[model samples]
Target: MKTFLLFCWLPLTAQAACPTLLNQQLPGLMGGTVDLCQYADRPVLVVNTASHCGYTPQFTKLEALYKRYRDRGFVIVGVPSNDFHQELERNSDIGKFCLANYGVSFPMATKAHVVGPDAIPLYRQLITVSGDAPRWNFHKYLIAPGGTTVTSYGTRTEPDDPKLIGQIEDYLNGMPAPAPSVPPPAPPRLKAISGS
Candidate 1:
């Protein structure tokens, strides 16, 4: 009985360890559930990409970045999106285009709506945390280890941008990644004293 109970609790512990943003299993381009939680504790770069977009060439740079940093616990997950109408109609086609054109080997997700009401849970959480949704294809979000923070980059921000690469390096090195400034805590409200 104790062994059976331990087995049941182990699964719960594993699920709890998944970041809220990546708690679900998203469908992969290759026809299997990509259990995102498995990548927990690793810095992940999530890009909303399209096959036919002009920025499609960015895949080459993304693959380069992935290959350069993957051994250091960094991974890139491409989320093929059609919200901008720039993606191929079929997931298989997108997969082929990425592999053939850029030799992309990073994990790719099925075509997903990455903005507004139809956005997937992962994308929604990304927006909620970063306050930046994909304005167009190739928008990128770099999620630091522990998934407590995310940095947003516009579609035009190339994968090799110094600022982006610097932050990724910092995260992988266990240093704090460059972050947006947060306002200091508001001054304590003073209580009014009434003298009768």
Candidate 2:
């Protein structure tokens, strides 16, 4: 009876360990779905990206970061977004660009909405929990192991930023995440124009 009870409880524990924010399967960049839950136990950097954006060059640095820390339980997920009118229309083109130009091996999601009400379920929850949204392509959200905590970095925060690296290392080493950085200013809301 004790063995039976232990077996029943183990699955529940595993399920509960995965963060709700990470319990999503995004359309994979190449094909199929990229299961976020698979990275729940590691420190994963989720960045909203665009193939033609000015910050696109950051992908090179990002790939470097992934190569450096991936062996230590770190992952980086690129979420291509066209909300800013910069991403390629086809996932295949996007994937090819990433591979040919930057050699990005980390997981990447197909084009997604990273802003406003149309944002994907994962991005929506990330916005609500962190009170920050991708203001532009390359905006990043650093989620600690198990999503126990999250920190936001704006588009300009380079992948090699010391503070960003420090936070990642902290998570990998089981250290507490650093305090939230000063968030970017909220975007201006458009007033409804009443017409006669």
Candidate 3:
């Protein structure tokens, strides 16, 4: 009985020690903390965004998808980046534009460097574990309910694209529903840009 109890406790103990997504908390434009761990048990769709990039329009689809599945235990997180020379001049300004233009109500993190040497620690871990990095704006990471990165999609993957949506639905409706309130930690802040 002792050994069985120890075995059961082992995995729980390890999870407590594991670095969770909520540890890196980032402030959202709405003045709230964006903690990935809050949505820990839910499937997350992470996207690197840019305001001026051609893919910027994807925000519309992204938001639509969020509304469609958010109640079903799926979330879409947007991380603004200037790595492609396409983001707004300021992090706050990026928020403003996203709100004014895209009507984006989903959570968004502060602007951060997503590539190169100064990339945020979260992105670094993402790259290391997935063997891929944000190649361009709109690159997506699909995280399973268990906090493991399940898959990655390229820039061409639209937010409502069938392939992507199907996977999310599968995970959301799978055996045990994912935890919906745990969010990951915030990524490191990047150099702030001046609003244009």
Candidate 4:
């Protein structure tokens, strides 16, 4: 029992060693701390969201994509922002609104600035490497598995757009397909020499 418990707890502890790009924590909209490291080695779609933006409706498709691919190691992270003055005033309000309006079940961060020098550290790093930043709410950054590749998308690209979906499919399919399960060689057939 103790060994089983230890094995179960190992992954949680291992999250502490995630790569730099994902080695941080943020307040989750669901009233908990979301350790970004836990998502390392998984493809993640990070979006800067706002409650009152014209593109707000994208949440539905975003949630849909999340539901469709999450079981396959895909994640969607929503970062509520007021940089464009479209976000709600409080995290609770933003969380409630998203749930009520779009049925969003993915993780979301507390409201923060996602543009300019005041942007969060992660966003700054994203901008530094991607050479593009959120020009408007709902702008997305798709981080490929292993947290190495990042692709930027403008707000005009809806979550369900074929182009975006294709990239996601490509990345996911690119992962070395799981090795087929091979049964252990049938325990060498028991041979009873039986002192013959």
Candidate 2's residue-wise lDDT over 112-157, tens digit each?
Answer: 8988889999899888888998888998899988786889999999
| TM-score sort, best first | 1, 2, 4, 3
Off by over 4 Å in 1: 175-196
lDDT of 3 by residue, 62-127 (tens): 999999988877888888998999988777799889999999988998888888999877777677
**TM per prediction:** 0.87, 0.82, 0.78, 0.82
Which portions of model 3 miss their true places by more than 4 Å? Answer: 1-22, 175-196
What is the C-alpha lDDT profile of model 1 across 1-196, one tens digit per residue? 9999999999999999888887888899978877788878888999999988889899999999999987777889999988988888999998898899999989999999899999999999999999988899999999988889999999999999999999998988894443566999999999999998
Q: Which ten residues in a row have the lowest lDDT in candidate 2?
A: 172-181
Using lDDT as the yardstick, the better of models 3 and 4 is: 4
Alpha carbon lDDT of each predicted model? 0.90, 0.90, 0.83, 0.88
| Of 1 and 3, the candidate ranking higher by lDDT | 1
lDDT of 4 by residue, 1-196 (tens): 9999999899767765677788788889878987788788788899999999899999999999999987777889999999999888989999899999999999998998899889998899788878999999999999888788789999999999998899898888877664577888877787778775
Cα distance off (Å), candidate 3, residue 156: 0.9
- Candidates arranged by lDDT, highest first: 2, 1, 4, 3
Give residue 139's error in model 2 in angstroms: 0.4
Candidate 3, lDDT over the whole model:
0.83
